[model samples]
Target chain A: MNWKTVLRLVSVDVKSGRLIRGQRLRRYRERRLFQYLLYGGACVLGIVIGLGAGTLYTAVPDPDLRTLFYEGARLLFLSFPIMVLIYSLIFTMMSQIQRMGVRSSIQLPYWLPITWEEHTLASTLAHLIGVPLASIILFGSAIATVSIYLEAVPLAILTIFALVASAFLASTTTEIFRVLQARLIGAVYKSSGRAAVWVRFLGSLLFLIAFYVAWFALTSGGGSIALIEMVASAQQAGWFVPYVWLGMALASFMNGLLAQTIIFSLASLLFILVLFYVAVKLNAKFGLYEPPAITVSRGAYVPKVGFLGRLGFSSLEAAVIRKDFKAFTRRRELMYVFIMPLVFILMPLMQYSGIYGTPVTPGSSRFLSAWILLAPGAIMAVMLGTIIIGEEGGSVWLFFSSPITARSLVKCKYAFVIIFSCIVTLVCGAIGILIARPSPDIAVVLLIESMLLIFALGAVSLGTGIKGADFTEVPRPRMVRPLTVLVYGLLCLVLALAIFSPLLLHAVAMEYIPLPVSLPKLDLYVAISISAVIALVVTFVFYKIALKNAEEFLIKAEI
Target chain B: MILGLIKPDSGSVNVVCTKAEDDPVAVKRQVGYVPESPRLYDFLTGLEYLDFVGDIYGLDASEKKARIEEYLEAMELEGREGDMISSYSQGMKQKITLISAFLHKPKLLLLDEPLSSLDPRSARIVKDLLRKLTAQGITTIMSTHVLEIAQAMCDRIAIMYEGRLLALGNMKELRQKARLPGSDLEDIFLKLTGTEDVREVVEALLK
Candidate 1:
């Protein structure tokens, strides 16, 4: 429709990630240069590598070896389109998932005088420009440059065209699916009514699981190259499938089957056009639609002190804890935070279950079990700790205006992180125990280490979050400053390692090291005791820091 | 600064008898504030949100419930209090914000555009409620763009232009200061703010 409008919209989406760099550096020219640098650098690297390979290829004067090189290169080039298509499809779809929130990557200006087709096309093109575009440019440059020496420039040209077309095909398909996902989620919410919160959570969790499952299945065995080879073989047998048509077209062209190439290319073109048409229509129908409000509760005007008092929290602290819990469970944007740790835990468990073709050996099993027991809870602690205060976003004024002391703020937030982390640890440890059957002593060690890391890292991140919470919600919500997150993650890693080192050394000493006759034996419990003390000291120090930061944050409300 | 929502840059700040810098929480305890644009927790139902705020202010269970229910009914939001605030319209959200400011019954109220997004009935109710609260010894500091509301509702009005107070007094005193003794509050405000050349700006724009 409106080419100028579409390009303008696409530019915004392309540079959306840079919007979180803070308010002062909102200059468009700088962002545009940065965006260009990514792709341009990739292209340059690709070309340099191609030139080196081309020079080496020409120097290999042996006819048979050269012939083999040509054959391998031909196979790779033929399959490149389908490979790009799958990558483009999966990445674009994953990006689309994040865009499902109220503040999507590009907030479509629905109130503006732009048509649906223009908006849909702009989104599709924008999604393509990041990973998918970089990929095509890199591979396309290398293949096209190397083709000069291979004496197959025409075929490389054809393959490149097919690659670009397939990327569009995948992106347009993702656009359709994105709109469909919104419509389906809305429908489910409407029909479920009172149970909307639970239904939406489980439904989205299942969807996320299915997406990962399909992704792992596709890239499981020998990775993308193997998958590409499989797809290349399958293309011939499954020529009727339109997804593989672009690859088949290139294959046909390489085999000197001009007629077949024309037919397959035309079919591929038609399929993409049809997908585009359907996507545009879907966008027109539901792009501007708002989902119905989810009703979690009804018919109540009662306030209770609740069971949090039993846990020794003040009313103010308990109220904040309950509110944060509801926010996590009920808010769609926050649901991802809850599901991510579960998914991280599930992945290894799936491997242990032999679902991913990895049988659990006793050695591997113990390590996996330890990982399951220790990692997810600590990771969740760190993540939730950093995001807890920042998740208040614009609503932070409530804390400022209320009579909440800094100590109460830190105490409540820290308590929530600890409680949630403990729950995750127990759940994951239980599953790991069921699957791996780790020895009781090791299980105790794992659990203790997990709890210690959670306590220590939770305080560290909470302190970091308080100091550097980013309340920017436009485009999308950025909980903490990127630099702060980086430093916090590094510090957590170092702290976790320090806490785990004594126990790890004990394990190593007992299992492998010869006992020095001069040294006294180190007991397992002794090492765990040392770790617990270290964790407590770290927690206490950081908890105090978090309190200080909270005081400053409370006083500096943007109100 | 009075509510301790922000730290004062140069001046010493006090709320009630507490110095804000020394004890912001104590200062906050004595003050209830509704910002210009209320950014509320949309995930919680209105009742849950109000309850949370009540608890934060250390309201007992029965008192919190009674106050929340009374305010909801007063604001015509009784039936809808159970719905998540994300589901509420702008007016409903503004009403909830107003009720939150009033829920704890602090000694002082700081409201910015308190009647914004309110229906006429809700606005009237809030105006009457504010007057009642004032009579009962609760101090109100309200800021609004509507001069009529300020002229009608305020005991002492402060006319601010560009973050500086241009004038401060009751209506009669302000009328005298502007030297337009018979003029309405709008003209007096314009004259005091030195933006009385409204005709010239409009004429330039038309040309």
Candidate 2:
């Protein structure tokens, strides 16, 4: 074994890691105002939340119950480090699925004069920053929380060891996920519409269930009944639930069972090493293998398509929407973004389902209905702006050089966003009304507001995308910088308030209409009509502004 | 600019009767461009990408379907529509781009290093295709560093160095201008581009 070469490769990984961080810091530093605003806001918010949490804790009057709750909170806090490790595995695996493996644009090292082993090792080592960083933060926080209620240094040491083992396991399994992601994409991407749709839906549904399960376990915010139920589910997770051993070790430490703690700790270490060996073997078999060229004959099953769209896109604009829709559908990873808003909207329905036997009203929370509309509207808007340009990857030059006008280009993307967002909002709105049964006037007002939100959201998202678009990207890099998201969000918030202002006035005016406006239904109809007119006017104005800005920006766009 | 994509800081571009600045949309419609390494939408199927371009060109339903299928078959891509363009080989992408550029049947065609990914047979097919299009009165301008291909294929050649045109002419005119009658295109290009003694560089490399 060339230990020297391995060490050299390791050093290069360290240097490259440092270089990447340095560049990021430098870029952030370049935008000093935005960076300062973001960091400053976060720090202030942290301080405020900490003070409030402290106040809430001390304000509890029931001493016995409070003590019991303190123990529960300590146990929960102690579970965080272990939870972090598990999450690291889950999230890393999901993101790796987003990657195209050896065919990835980032695979520049494939062309370098390096051995497969060295390349894999260096690339793997380079990513060591993420797991370690998460481990340290969670370890420190867990220790701090537990230290407040108990004094167990030995338990702390065991917890640290378990964390290291978990991190090691997570890091090594990176290539495993890469292979899984690649194979999954290959199978689904090659299939026709029906197969693709099923795979996309199934993938998103699994993640949603997993997300809910994890969230329920961590929060159990519903009550002791929910907590007991979560514990039962955890017990039912079967024999391979080794992750629970971390908690078991902590529980043993809390109860002063040294033997069990020692055993669990040793077993965890052993498991980590076994996983490392398996991971290395998997990496050799999969990650180290070079990707073959895309052979024309391999794809010998071209699917026929309709000449015209189902949504009546007869002109040049249809082409843009068709391409965008196709790209969006083909990349199943992106489907989660599309599915997630509906998931959120369905939350109350799921919560109030017959299983709970809870009394539910569909339109009970007008604010929630508004939130449902805005959340999905926001996602679609940001997607429209960022995705339309970003998904173009390198191929965007085709559109840029085409006979298509900038106005029409912007219009086409916005039209898709409008169509997609409106359909989803209406469906969710109907469901919300059916379940919650809010007043007809409020629902009508919300429908109008939903349309306004779509227009405003698109404008904000497109503007942000135009500012920071890097066209030569695939699944394009974050089109809106974090600061840009905040800025655009604030901008959209203003637009929302402005658009809803007229509707709000109408809603408040319901209580004290003059004698001449005696009929309640007539007044409600008048209010809805006025608001609808206002929404129409606002949408037209914002759409024009957004189009003008986008046209100017695109005309000057370098790539 | 004649490219229609980038605006010229000074001067103007005129393609056919219309100045590019006057109506860039019209100029874009008139011109067919095939960039050397065109970025393709990886998420669309090969057939979908064709239909997309055909729709933009405003081709009728039957015409679009017929032409798209014909070209896909011509390019041996008829069977590849099930897969996303993301899964397509570089040559396949090049073929599709070429087909899109040709499908429009514009007044002018601009192709840049069009045969980079093609095998010999496909390259020959492209040469014949270009000849056919040019014969159909569609003015085709191709930029390639391959001297033999440029000499053999192009009706007129433009040699550019550092973003400035060094020479523009027919094969005979360029030969006369370079004072290298009966000499190869490589020599003429080298003379025009101001590169010195390539034989020495070749010798050094061999050594």
**Candidate 1 per-residue lDDT over residues A446-555, each given as its tens digit:** 99899999999999999998987987765567788989999888999999999998887786677633434333456888989999999999999999999999888888
Clash pairs (backbone) in predicted model 1: none
The estimated TM-scores of all candidates read 0.93, 0.79
Worst 10 contiguous positions by lDDT, candidate 2 chain B: B78-87
Expressed as tens digits, the lDDT of each residue in A452-527 for candidate 2 is 6676667657656656555433322333345666776677677767666665556555533233443334365565
Backbone clashes in each candidate structure, one number apiece? 0, 11
Runs in model 1 deviating more than 4 A are A14-18, A25-32, A55-65, A103-111, A215-221, A349-360, A512-521
The model with the greatest DockQ is 1
